[model samples]
Target: MSASPPSPGLAPRPAHDATWRRDAHTIGLVGLAHGTSHFFHLLLPPLFPWLIRDFGFSYAQLGLLVSVFFAVSGVGQALAGFVVDRIGARPVLFAALGCFALAALAGATAQGYGGLALASALAGLGNASFHPVDFTILNKRVSTPRLGHAFSVHGISGNLGWAAAPLFLTGLTHASGSWRIALAGAAAWAVLVIAVLTSQRAAIADRAPGEHGPAHHAAARGEHPLAFLKLPSVWLCFSFFFFSTCALAAIQSFAAPALHTLYALPLEVASLVVSGYMLTGAAGMVVGGFLVARVTRLERIISTALVASALVLLTVGQQWWPATAAGAGTAALVLTALAGLGTGLAGPSRDMLIKQAAPPGATGRVYGTVYSGLDLGFAVSAPLFGALLDHHQPAGVFGGAALALLLGVACAALVGVGVAARRRAA
Candidate 1:
C-alpha cells in the first residue's frame, strides 16, 4: 500500500532547511568580509609600475614594501587568533575593517615611501585578523553537512576580491590620472562595507568553539598560552600553507610581467591573462565545493590537484611547445588558467583538511597559526622574485613558483600521513 500523505501541521519545514538558511546568511557575511581583506591585499601590487615611476624606488625596495606588509601580517595573524579566542571574533573583525580603511587613507595621502610603509603596516594589521575571525565563525555556526560549500564560497569570494582589485583600482587610476584618487575611492569602499557588516553583526558574531567551558576554565587555571604548539598536525598544516602560497604569491606579484616577457604580450593582454586565471580559479572553487561533499578522501583530492597544478606550472616555466608567437601566447594563457583550476579545486579540500586537524576548542588559534604561513610565504616571495626581475630573469619567477608547488605536493602528503598516524594512535 502507498504511504499516507502527511497532514499540513505535520509537514512543517525540515530542520535542515532552517539550518541551510542560517549557513547561507553566515557564509554570505563572512565571505564579504574575507573578500574585502583580499581586495586590499592587491591594493598596492598592481600599481607597482606606477609606484616605481612616482617614488623612484628600485624593484627590490618596492618588493620590500610588500614584504613588510605580509611580515607584519604573519606575526599579527598568529597573535590575533589568540585574541579572537579570548575576546570573540566580532570586535576583532570590526577593528580589522577599521584598520583597512585607515590604511587606504594613509596610502592615499602619503607623500613618500615612509608614509606608504606605514600604511602597508597598518593594512597588515587589519589583514591579520580575517582568517581567525572567519574560520572561528564558520566552524562554530555552520552546520556540518554544509560546511564544505561554506568554505568554497569563502575561497571563491577571496579569489573574486583578488580579481576585482586590479580592475577597480587600475580603471579608476586611468580615468582620474591619479593613483591616490583610486586609493581614496578604495578607502571609501571599505567604510561602506564596514557599515554593511556592522548592520548584520548579530547574525555572524560567534565565540570560538569550546570557549565557555573546558578551554576557558583551563586558561583561568593558567594553562600555557603556547599549548597548541604541541600538535604536530598544526606545524604540518603551517608548512602546507607556506609552500602552497609561494605559487600564489608568484601569480599575484609577477604573472602579468612574466607572461609579457615569455609570450611577447602587451601589458593589457598580460593583465587580462592574469585576471582570467583568477576568474577561472573562482569557477574551479565552485566545482571543488561540490566535489568536497562527495569525495571521501580529501588528501587524495588535494594531492592530485597540486600535482596537476605543478605540472602545468612546470610546462609554462619551461616555455616548451607552442612554436608560433600566436601559439605561445595562447599556450601561456591556457596553462595559467589550467593551473588555477587545479589549485582552485584544492582550496576547499585544503580547508577541510585543516578543519579535521584542528584540536577541540582551538580552531581559532590553529587556523591563525597555520594561515600565517601564507603571509610568510607572501613576504618571502616578493623580495625573492623581485630580485629575479631586477636581474632580468623573468623565467626564474615562474620556475621558482613551480618548484614551490612540487614541494607543496610533498607537504600535502606529509600532512596526510601525519593526520592518519594521529588518528590511528587515537
Candidate 2:
C-alpha cells in the first residue's frame, strides 16, 4: 500500500525564511525544559551533606530519600508517555514544571525526613515527564536536516543542568546562610521558567504527527497500549540505555574515589579529574552534534564510540600504567576525559537510533519505556558498586563500569543490525 501524504499541520516549515529562528526557539525551549529536569535530578543530592547536618539523618536515610525519587521517577516515566500521547505533550510539559515548583517548595519548607521524601517523590514525578515531552516536541517541530543538532543541544543542556546544580545550590546557600533559601530560590526559578515557556507556548504546542485526524484516532482506538513491546528493536534500545547508564552511574558516583584510592592522589586533584571528565563530555557532545549532522551511519558511530569508551575505562580500571603520584593523576585525568568524550560522541547518534526504532505515532511511549532503563541502571549501580567500595576494591568499580560499557557496545551493535534488517525488509 502507498503511504499517506504528510499532514499539513505536521509538515516541516520552509527552509528559506525564519526557519533558523524557529528551530532556535524550539530547541531553546525544549532544551531549557530538559535542563531544568536534570538540574532537579541532582539538586537534592548535592544538598545531602547539609541535610545530614540539619536533620540529623544518617547516610542510609538520606540515600533512601534519593532512591525514593528515582523509584517514583522510573515508574512514572514509563506511564507518562501514555498520557503525553493521549492528551498531548504541552499540558504534560506544563504540569511537569508545576511538579518541580511544588517539589522545591516542599523541600524548602520541610523540617523532617518525611517531608523531604515527599518533596523528592514530587520532584521525581515531575522529572518523569520530561524525556517524552521534549523528544515528542523536537521530533515533530524541528526540521529534519537540523534534528541531529537539536538533539545535541538538548543533551548539552542537560549536562549544563547537572553541572549547574552544585554551583547554583552551593552558591545560593552561601549567599543566603540557609539551604532553605536556596531551595526557595530554585522553586522561584522553576516558576520563572514556566512563565517564559508559557509565553512561548505556541512554539511548543504538541504537533503530534496526526493530531485530531484519522491516523491519530486510529492509533488511539485500534492499537493496543502495550503494542510497542512487540518490536524487538524497542527491547534492544532499552538494553542500550540500561548498560550505558550503568557505566555512567559508576563514573558519576565513584570515579573520583577510585582515582584517589588507586594513585594516592590528593582529594583536590581527584575532584579535578572528575570535573574534567564532565567538562570534556560536554565538549564532546558539541562535537557529536556536528558529526550527527554529517554522518548517516549512526549505528557505526555509536558502536565505535562505545568501544573506544570501554577500552579507555578498562585501561584505567586495570591501572595498566604505573602509578607515580603526579603521573598517575595526569593519566587518570586524561583517560577519564577520553572515556567521557567517547560516550559523549555516541549520545546524539544513540538518540537518533531510538528515533528509528520507535513505532510510528508512538514516540512518547517508546522513549518513556526505553529511558526507564536509565533509572533502573542507576538504582542498581549504587548498591552493586557500593559493595565493591565496601569490600575495599575501588578498582573493581571501574572494572565493572568497563564491563558495562562493553556490554552496551554489544547492545548498540545488535540494535544497529536489527534496524538495518528492518529497513531492508521494508
Candidate 3:
C-alpha cells in the first residue's frame, strides 16, 4: 500500500502510510543515521589492536588518527551548520551521509596509515553534519513536551552504536578472518542508510520548513559569527561543556583499561563494568530529559549536578581498605552514572541556553561554535588522560577529571548569573 504523505505544515512523514508507522520510521531513520555515524567513527579504540597488529603503527600514529577525526569534526560541524542554514537540512544531511559512505568505502580500502588518516578525516567531516540538522528537525517536528525524550532516545541510539561498534567489528573480523571485509561490511551499512535517507527525502522535506525564526534570530543577534566569542555566557557554556565532556571521554575511552591496570580484574570483567556505565547512561538520558522540564532552577540544577559528579568521581580514587578495588569499581560506576545522568539532564537546556545566548539568527553558528568546545573537550581529554594513566595511577586520572568537573560547575554558575542578567536587561 502506498503511504500517505504528511499533512502540509507538519514535519515530514517517514515514507509510511500510518501515523504510528511513519513516526517509527522517522525515529528509525534518525537512529540509523546516528548509529552508523558513531559505529564508524568510534571504531578506533577497538581497531587499535587490529591496526597495531596488522600495520605496525605506533601509539603516536594511532593517536594522531583519532585526534584528526575529532579535530576535523570540531571545525566541520560549524561549516555543516552554516551549510545547513543556507541549504536546509535535507540537502546537508544527504551530503553528510554521502561523505560517510565514501569515507567508509575508503576506510575499507586503506593500505597504510596515511590512507587510514584520510579516510578518518572524511568520515569525521561527514559525521559532523548530522547533529545540528537532526536536533533542529526534532525540535521542529516533535512536540516540545516530548522533545527531551526524543533527544534522549536519539542519544541512546548513539550510545548503543558506541557500545556495539567494537564488538561488532571484533565479531565481524574474527568471523570473516579479514579486517578489510569487516570494514567493508561497515561501509555497506552506511550505504544502506544513505539509500534509506534518499528514498525518504521528499517526505522529510515536506514535513516542515526548517526553523526560520531562530535561524534568523541567530543571525541578527550576532552581526558576525565571531561576535559570541567575546560573550562571557557563550564562553562560559563552552567551558562548562568542555570540562564535562573531558571527564566523559576519559570514562568512555579509558576507564575500563584503567580499572584493569589498577585491579586484577580480567579484561572481560572490566569491559562489562564499562558497558554498565554506558547502558546506565542511556537510562539517565531519558530520565534527564524528563527532569529538565520539572526542575525550576536550571542553573542550580546544573551546578549541583556538576559538584555531585565531581565528588562521586573523586571518591573512586580515594584511599580505602582491602575491599578497596571492589569499592572503587562500584564508586566509579556510580559516579560515572551520576555524571552521565547530569549530562543528559542538562543536554537540552545547554543547547537551548546557547541558542538563547546567541544573537538572533545565529543559532547555527552559535551552536556550531559552542559545539567546538565540546569537541575540544573530547579531543584534548583522551590523550591527556592517557598520559596521566601512563605516568600516575588510574586514581590520578579520576582526580584530574574531578578537578575538570569542578571547573565546569563554576562555569555553569556563571551562566546562571548571565541568565539572570539577561532577564533583568530584557
Q: What is the C-alpha lDDT of each candidate?
A: 0.86, 0.81, 0.68
User: What's the lDDT for residue 31 in model 1?
Assistant: 96
Instruction: Pick the winner on lDDT between candidates 2 and 3.
Output: 2
Relative to the true structure, candidate 3 reaches a TM of: 0.83
Model 2: per-residue Cα lDDT over 29-121, one tens digit each: 999999899888865765765886787875446556667777788898899888887778899999999999999999999989888988999
Higher lDDT: candidate 1 or 3? 1
TM-score of 1: 0.94
> Highest TM-score among the candidates is held by which one?
1
Candidate 2 segments exceeding 4 Å error: 1-15, 52-63, 174-177, 208-215, 264-269, 272-275, 322-324
Q: Highest lDDT: give the candidate number.
A: 1
RMSD of each: 2.7, 6.1, 6.0
Model with the higher TM-score, candidate 1 or 2: 1
What would the TM-scores of all predictions be? 0.94, 0.88, 0.83
TM-score (C-alpha, index-matched) for candidate 2: 0.88
Q: Which ten-residue region of model 1 has the weakest summed lDDT?
A: 207-216
Q: What is the model-wide C-alpha lDDT for candidate 2?
A: 0.81
Per candidate, the number of residue pairs that clash is 0, 0, 16
